[model samples]
Target chain A: MNAEDRADHFIGRLDAAAAAVEQKLDALLAPSTLKGEIERPARLLEAIRYATLGGGKRLRPFLVIESAALFGLSGEGPLRAGCALEMVHCYSLVHDDLPAMDDDDLRRGRPTAHKAFDEATAILAGDALLTYAFDVLADPATHPDAAVRANLVLALARAAGLGGMVGGQALDLAAESAQKPLNQQEILTLQAMKTGALLRFAVDAGAILGAADQRQAATLTRYGAALGAAFQVADDILDAEGDAAALGKRAGKDAERGKATLVGLLGLEAAKARRDALVEEAIAALEETGLGDATATLAEAARFVALRNS
Target chain B: MNAEDRADHFIGRLDAAAAAVEQKLDALLAPSTLKGEIERPARLLEAIRYATLGGGKRLRPFLVIESAALFGLSGEGPLRAGCALEMVHCYSLVHDDLPAMDDDDLRRGRPTAHKAFDEATAILAGDALLTYAFDVLADPATHPDAAVRANLVLALARAAGLGGMVGGQALDLAAESAQKPLNQQEILTLQAMKTGALLRFAVDAGAILGAADQRQAATLTRYGAALGAAFQVADDILDAEGDAAALGKRAGKDAERGKATLVGLLGLEAAKARRDALVEEAIAALEETGLGDATATLAEAARFVALRNS
Candidate 1:
């Protein structure tokens, strides 16, 4: 199929995967009237539901489902795992938009968690979503094999923990007080940790679910890394040129916040070139996995990450 | 031994366990230079270390260690598992003391996390600690059996997650704006979810580590529930009578904040009575376990929960 056709096909699959994940999330977090309750508090649940369901690209889940399908393993395991990843992703957004963090009032064209609920409820919602992610992964229903569940938990913990997303956030906070701008390498390191880490986990998680060998996992991991970089570069590009209305978040805020970006360092054309190169690298790594034509949609996903306007 | 002597013995053991856990936390969280870094960021690490490491009674860890000792399965597993629980406990405190939450400046006789570090760092540190807890629990080093690690992860997630600690916090927040003071039953359910959940998990985790049969697990769970209730009731007693110098936190704040507590529902004398009854109930549950002398320390712990000052 042509590139445009392939991208359309990937978008269709992404929509389907996102819908499935939303269903899983709803069932997992449905409002409950437990025994002996005059009323169950609904604010936290509302905040969590607002922060999650019915928005965003669901790209990470798509990566997970597609990557798992490469090994002919497509079922509850990958879908639930993907939902867990999405939960983490959603939780990060909730916390990141807090008044003390990014102070974002809008997310996905709606009021952010702290805006929709309150600061305390938003914090609790983020904490709840994060904690719930692990519970979902560790449940026997996610995968009957305890070992696989354990591996997923470990991998996710590492990706989301001190040396990964949280640590990166610390660095980002430190940058505000930094005496000097971060150099190119520092920017790359920061972005890799802040954003790339979870995306990498998205694809790598599929390998774990499919029980891929070390070499196979490594190949997919490289693809994930490259795709992650491409996605970030595209994000930078979008931040520079996209409209806030379309992006569903404030655009150009990164530059306004004095945050470092590759696009700022390399200029628009160079950043675009870098994105395309990374997408090529991602496709090449997928080819190395020997999944052949099965990787077409995944390949298109990498291309879409580099080229998407919003 | 006499009851006083038995309580003293448990205290001594708790001191030793706390020391061991301190060492483990130090090693796990020591600031490190990752790949391609001249210096690691210190603020986040410092906040996490400060929030944990040196304060509190280590009561949950004590529970895990003492409860695991019943089966003579004292090893890295229980210690690490206990530390994981402690991390979750610590993270909860860090977030709970945020300006948006309880707004306490003091915790364990020092400045709270948000007070010591800025709000963003405190939030990230808590997130890091929470994320790190799962990493510790899921590691092979925690338990050779992946199934055991997975179970630990699952249990910790449940206790600390949406339906547990975070959910409880949300309920507590709603109570402030609540038109009516929480009734006795509402207060009981809130306290059970907020404080009792993790404490219950602490003891239940020991059963999992011990590979207890269903009957044995249920007995221990009952013990945990009673012990958890006793601890919260005793905490209410302390809040009413204990000085800040002794409690290491503001005393009488619950009443000042219009927060619901068992002490508020029942008068001081009745709250004390309830504590004693729960401790006795805890001891009875332990007796039913048929572990005999192995439960001596556990029984003493229940009394300590009821009677300890600060």
Candidate 2:
């Protein structure tokens, strides 16, 4: 199929994947009723449910499901892994929206967690979601093998922890008030950690689940790395040019805060060129995986990253 | 030995345990130096170290080490597990002391995390510590067995997640603006969840590590539950009667905030009576373990819970 038709076909599959994730998340985060003498508080679950349900592209889970598909491992395992990853993503957004952090009033075109609920509830909700993600991954339901479960737990923890997302966030905040502006290499490192680490984990999680051999896993890892960097560049492009209503968050934030971004350092055209090159590299990395057409949609995903408006 | 002397003996061990935990934590959370192009931020590590390194009684780790001692597993495994649990505890404290939560200015007789660092840094530090805890636990270094590592991650996640500590924190927040005051049973459930879950896990973790049989594990679980309840009651008593200088935090916070506390439900004397009963129950449960002399220090630990000044 041609690229446009391929992209269109993948978008349909993406919507289906997103719907499946929402259903899975709904069942996973169902409201609690006080059973027996023990009273399970409904408020925390309510906050978690609110933050997770009915939003986002569900791209991380889609990547997980798709990558696992490359190795012929589909069904509940990849989907559940996706849910856990989404929980981590949503939790980051919820905590990042707190008054003490980004202080954004809106996310996914709705009130942010701290805005929808009180700051205390929002903080607790984020903590619960993060803890729950690990719980979900460690459960026998996620993977039957104990080793796989342990590996998933370790991978997710490392990706989301100090050396990864949280550390990157610290760097991002430090950059804001920094006396010296972060140069290109520093900004690249910051973005890779804050945004790319979890994406890398999402793809790596599939390989771990599918039990890919070292070389196969390495190929997918490179693809994920390239895709992640491309995704960030596209995001920078969107921030520079997209509308707030379309984006569901404020646009021009990087420029407004003087936050160092690729688009800010390089002009829009040069940034677009960079994104296109990364997408090409991501697609090329998939060629060595020997999955043939099974990787076509992943290449489509890379293209989608380069061109998505929001 | 007399109960007083036994308690004193256990107190000395607790002090040693705390010292050991501090030393391990220093090694675990040491400042990072980058080997490659990537630079792990020093500021984030600084915040984590500042919040964790030199503070508190390290009571939770004491519980883990003491309980693990029951099973004759007193090498680096239990000590590392204790450090992980303490990291989770310290993270919770850091987040709980945020301006949006308790708004506490002092913790362990020093500036709270948010006060010492910016709010964003404190939040990131807490997130980092929580993430690092699981990373430490999942590492094979924590245990030789993969199954054991997975179980530790699972148990810690459950205790700290929506159904446990964070859930209780949410309930506590809901109670603040709640139209109706929580009744005795409701307050009991909340306290068990918020404060008791981690303590229960500390004991349970040791049982899991020592590979106790079902009956032995259950015995330790019961001991943990009773000890946890007693610990909360003692904390309430301290909040009501202890001096701020001694407590290292604002005294009478429950009364000032109109928080639902056991001491509020029962009068101070009655609360102390309840704490003593729980302590007896805790000691009684230890008797079933049949460790005999090996469990004396644990029994002494129960008494220490009832009478700790801070």
Candidate 3:
């Protein structure tokens, strides 16, 4: 394919993965009761569906699907596991948008889950979704191998839990009223936990699902880390310079809240330079995997992360 | 043994189990980072510890230990699993006490997690604890058998997710603003999801950890359902008639909020009667397990649930 056609192909693949995940999430979030349980509360399920199902770039699931495809395992297992990862992402968004957390009223051009529903429903929905992600991963259908499923649960819980995403958010909250701006290392650690951990998990999970060897897995880890950092820096750049209408949420709030970010520390031009170097680093790691052309899409993903406007 | 002596032994066993689990939670909540992660924030860890370390009856862990003992497995595995179950219980308390939920100012006679810390920390602490519960359960140390660990994750998630405790809370929240009092079936379903699910899981998880055969597992399920239901009915009875000083929460709020309960539907005497019958049913199920006196402590637990003052 030529350059333009290749770009279209990558976008098409990304969109297709998002749609697949959307369908999986819809089915997973249905009001039907599973075994060992009684009944699904309708409003809670509705809020969960609203928080997920139709928004965002679906970048996380796309990464999972593409990463799994690297090991020649383009099957239902990857898609199912990808949906589980996406559920965690959606749960975080729902909880973060609550009045107690980031307290935003808009997400992806729609009223936030709390605004559309009540705060109680939003909290319950977030809890249910997070729990269900583990449920899906542990189920026999996610993977026939019990060890793989168990490991996925362990890995995901860490990525989403203490010393990771939750800890990151706490650090960010504390940074808001701190006596001094965060040092670069502290900011990196916080960002890695808050956002980078989940993004890295997307690719790392694909490796687990594909049963990649230790060597292969480590290669993907490097790629995931670099890509995740690049994505966060790009996101910070957008928040700093992008418009609220294009961003679909409040923009320029990072500075307003006194939140420490790369853009604030490095200045826009240097941060842009950092993002470009990280993208190169990601692609280099992928090339080292020796999957060669099989990693073409992931290379594109690295570039895409650095370039996304919203 | 004399009756009093037997009671003393059971009480000691329960307290011992609680102490063991408390120690485990203390270690788990320490500000230490695990592999594949970054720093653990101090405030979040403190809030998690505060919510979990010193608290109400560790009844759930007691059930797990006692139930696992039925299969002659009295080891670290069951205790660790029990701690995981307790984490889930503590997380629910932290979230439920939030201003958006029960709006409680205190828990276990101290300021609620949200009150002691800010709402954001409490929310993150709850999320971290909940996520950490699954992390603990999925660890290789939780069980030698991957299938067992996977099954535990599946069971715990269902017990705690949409058709379980979270779902039940949502139902209760809706019922508070509901147009009318719920009917008997509605009230039963709501209560089952809200509280009975986790209580039931506390024993059912023991069965999973012990690798109980189908028939033995069914017997334990019967015991768990009866015990869990009896516990909840007793709780409702307390809310209706017990003092706030005794309950450590606002008394009679269920009636004030117009929340549906068996006590509201069937009256206090009838609810008490229901509680007693459930205890009988639980004891009978224990008797049927064919493990004979191995189930005696569980039988005692059923009675304790029905009779506790707080």
Candidate 4:
């Protein structure tokens, strides 16, 4: 296939995977309880569903699915793991949009969880969603291997907990009130933890689920790190100078909130340049994975990360 | 030992276990990062430590230790597992005290997490602590067998997730704004999820770690349920009638908040009777465990739940 055809095929696969994960999430969030569940309280379940089902690209889950594909893994286990990762992603957004946090009223063109439900409900929903992520991952259905499941749980906790996403958020909060502007290095660290960590985890998780060897895992992890970093840079670029109509959420808010971003540090031109280089770096890592044409869709994913406006 | 001496001995063991958990928590919350960490930001770490290290009876951890002792389970595995449970307990309290939630200023005679830090910090700290719980459970140090670790993670997530504690909190929030008082069955379901689930989980987790047979596990779980129910009832009785100074926080806030409690529905005297009956029920379950005198400390624990002024 030509490059354009391949890109189109990749997008199709991405959409299909997103739909699959959406179904998984819907079923998982349904009122029918899993083993050991006493009740799935209505309002809380509703709030959780609102936060999760309200749409995004489901890019994290897509990454997980594709990364597992690299290792000849597919089917329900990887799909469910991706859904688990997406739950964590969704929960973070719910909590981050709280009045005490970023205080966002809208997300993806709809009212944010807190705005729709109320602060207390939003907080509890976020808490439940986060808790449920582990529940999904630790379930035997996620992986037949207990060691793999345990590793996934540990890896996720490290990424999402302090010293990773939450700690990064704490840094972002401090950055807003810092006596001086954060240095580029500081912003890099913050961004890595706040956003990049989970993105990295998505593919790293695929590696775990697929039982990739050390070299393959490391290679995919490297690809993930670059793609994640590129994704953030593109985000900054879009937030700086892009179609507000295209991006379903707010734009220019980083500047409005004085959030530290690559676009803020490097000029937009340089940030775009960095993003392109990162895509190249990501593709290079994919090449190193020894999967050859199997990495084609994933390669398009890298380019898509750099090229997408939203 | 005679009954009183046995009771005294149980108290000593409880204190020792509390001290041990304190040390474990201190280490867990220290500046050092865990395996997959990038950085543990100062304020976030501080808020976490403040929430965790600030004094409590560590009743949940004690329950885990004593229950595990019933099967001769000891060492860092059980101790660390207990600490993991305590992290979840601490995180719950921190989030519960948030301005958007229960909005408290004091906890255990000190400023609540949100008060001591900020709302954002407290929320993030709570998030991190909750995340850290699974991190601890999934670690190899929690148990030798990967299956055991996976089981622990699944159990913790179930008890702590929407169908359990977080869901219960949502019910409590709904009750406060509820058009009518919660019915007796409704309150039981709420309390069982909110407070009872985690306490029950503590003992149930002990059984999991010890590889208890199905009957043994069921016996211990029944005891845990009764003990946990008794604990909440005693707490309600305390809130309704006793010990503002001894409880180290507000005593009558349930009434102030117009919250539903057993004391509110059944009145204080009937609540006390229920508490006594639960303690007896817990003792009976313990007797059925076939652990004999090994169950004595656990029996005392049930009594202590009923009799404690705090």
What is the lDDT, from 0 to 100, of the residue B209 in candidate 1?
85
Among residues 3 or more apart in sequence or in different chains, the pairs in candidate 2 whose N, CA or C atoms overlap within 3 Å are none
Task: Specify the CAPRI tier of model 1.
Answer: medium
List, residue by residue over A115-200, the lDDT tens digit for candidate 1.
88889989998998899899989999888899999999999998887778887887888886799998888878777888988999
i-RMS values of the candidates, in order? 2.9, 2.4, 1.8, 1.8
Candidate 3 C-alpha lDDT tens digits along A44-150: 88888899888878899899899999987776788888888888998899889888888999999999999999998988888988999999999998889999999
Between prediction 2 and prediction 4, the one with superior lDDT is 4
- Give the backbone clash total of model 2: 0
> How much of the true contact map at the interface does candidate 1 reproduce, as a fraction?
0.75
lDDT of 3 by residue, B195-225 (tens): 8898889888889988888999999988998
DockQ per candidate: 0.64, 0.64, 0.75, 0.75
A50-132, model 4: which lDDT tens digit per residue? 99994988999999998888888999888998999899999999998888888888888889988888899999999999999
Q: What stretches of model 1 exceed 4 Å from their correct place?
A: A32-40, B32-40
TM-score of each: 0.98, 0.97, 0.97, 0.98
| Candidate with the greatest TM-score versus the true structure | 4
TM-score of chain A of each: 0.96, 0.97, 0.97, 0.97
Residue pairs with backbone overlap in model 1: none
lDDT of all the models against the reference? 0.88, 0.88, 0.88, 0.90
Tell me candidate 4's TM-score on chain B.
Answer: 0.97
Candidate 2: fnat, from 0 to 1?
A: 0.74
Q: Give the 10-residue window scoring lowest on summed lDDT in candidate 2 chain B.
A: B30-39
Query: Which run of 10 residues does model 1 chain B get worst, by summed lDDT?
Result: B32-41
Given candidate 3, what's the lDDT at residue B310? 89
